[model samples]
Target: MSTGQGRLIIVVTVCVAMLLAILPMPDWARPFRPPWVTLVLIYWAIALPHRVGVGSGFVAGIVLDVLTGALLGQHALAMSVVVFIAIQLHQRIRVFPFWQQSLGILVLLIVEHLFGLWITGATRGTAPALQYWAGPFIGALLWPWTFVTLRKVRRHFKVT
Candidate 1:
């Protein structure tokens, strides 16, 4: 794909993922909601670091914060950390099999969650809940399918 086309695809992908992340699901399912946007952004940041980076992550997070009506930097901070780690480990991470990559994604999600909790605790004066970590675990479980499907979409669209 041409550079412009590739950039467009990445932007559309990120926006769709963010919209998915904030959609109103059933209450019982909310806790299990995977960080869909975060995972997709991190995957791209790792696979196409030249196209996705911390700036994209920060913007995505800020947009999410606005959409979700959460603290301004909550998602931004969490996503920034995820993208940072993904970029830092991009070399080793890209070579891993799907399962291994999922595991790494699990770790990244957990770190993001922890940072989120720390931030929440600092600002909201609330204790963290075990449920807070569930999103990452579920997100990690979905990573394999997410990675494959997104790769297919990218290829289908003739994106590089």
Candidate 2:
């Protein structure tokens, strides 16, 4: 694909992930909502570390913060850290089998949530309930499907 096309595809996917992140759900299902933006960022960071690294994560997270009305740099900081780790381990992560990859993704998601939790506790003087911790597990559970779908899109679009 052309440079512009490849960039466009990545941007579109990130935007879609952001949309999914903010989409409304029933009260009971809210905590189970997977961290879509984090998953997508992790995928791109691993798949194309050169093209999408910490900076991309920061930008995407900033947009997500604005969309979700979060503390200004909360998501940005968490996402940057997550993407940095993903980029650093991209090679090893790429070689892992699907189940192993999901385990790795779970670690990354847990880290992301930890950062968010830290920021929330520091700023608001309170922590979210137990339900807040469910998102990462759900995201991890969905990783295989997400990885497969994104890999297909990357290959089909020839997004180098």
Candidate 3:
């Protein structure tokens, strides 16, 4: 794709992720909600490090903060950190098998969650329950499919 087209694709993907982040879920299912925006950010960070790195993550995360009415920079900070890691290891992790990639995704999600917990606690909040950690597990479980689908989308769009 041309540079403009590739940039458009990135914007569209991030917009879709932003939409998913705000889409409502059932109360019981809320705990299981995968961090859709983070997952998408990770995928792009890994697959298109040059085009989608910390800046992209930080912008997406700030949008997330606004959409979710979260602390101003909470998700921004966490996502910046997570995407930094993904970008750093993108080359090596891209060579790994699906299972390994999923494991890496799990770890990244956990890191994001921990950052969130720390920030929230610092501002005054109790420790979240074990179920609060379910998002990472669910996100990790969805990694293979998410990877394949996003790869296909990027390829179809000819995103660089």
Candidate 4:
């Protein structure tokens, strides 16, 4: 596919993934929610750093902030951090085995969660719930599946 077509596909994928992540789930399953949006963001950040930069991260974060009803900039800041790191490490991450790359993604999710906690503390005037950290923990657990599925989509659709 041409560059514009690839970019369009990425955008649509991210939008659908974000909607999936933000859709309300049962309370029990909610805590185990995979960071679908984050995963896609990281994937694109690593795969197309020039096209998907920190600004894209920031914008996506803002959209997530609005969707999740957290403090306005919380997700934005966390996503910014993830994108920055992904940009820096893209070369290495792209070459790593799938398992190793998942581990790196886990670390990035952890950092994003920590930032979320910090922001919640600042804006909500209360400590974050234990369930809050569960996001990243479960996100880590889901990384392999997410990576595999997204990879298949990319390959099938020639998104990259």
TM-score head-to-head 1 vs 2, winner: 2
- Model 1 compared with the native: what TM-score? 0.94
- In candidate 2, position 155 carries an lDDT of 98
Cα RMSD, each candidate: 1.2, 0.6, 0.9, 1.5
lDDT of 2 by residue, 67-94 (tens): 9999999999999999999999999999
lDDT for each residue of candidate 3 in 1-160, tens digit (9 for 90 to 100): 6899888887887888788777898888777888989998899999999999899889988989999998999999999999999999999999999999999999999999999899888886777778989999999999999899999999998898
Could you tell me how far off, in angstroms, the CA of residue 18 lies in candidate 3 after the best superposition? 1.5
Model 1 alpha-carbon miss at residue 148, Å:
0.3
lDDT of 3 at 94: 98
Top candidate by TM-score: 2
Off by over 4 Å in 4: none
Clashes of each: 0, 0, 0, 0
For model 4, the local distance difference test gives 0.85
Q: What lDDT score belongs to each candidate, Candidate 1 first?
A: 0.88, 0.95, 0.91, 0.85
Residue 130 CA displacement from its true place in model 1, Å: 1.5
TM-score winner between 1 and 4, please give it: 1
Error of 2 at 94 (Å): 0.4
What is candidate 1's lDDT per residue for 121-148, written digit by digit as tens?
Answer: 9998997667878988899999988888
- Total backbone clashes of candidate 1, pairs 3 or more residues apart or in separate chains: 0
> Could you arrange the candidates by TM-score from highest to lowest?
2, 3, 1, 4
Best by lDDT: 2
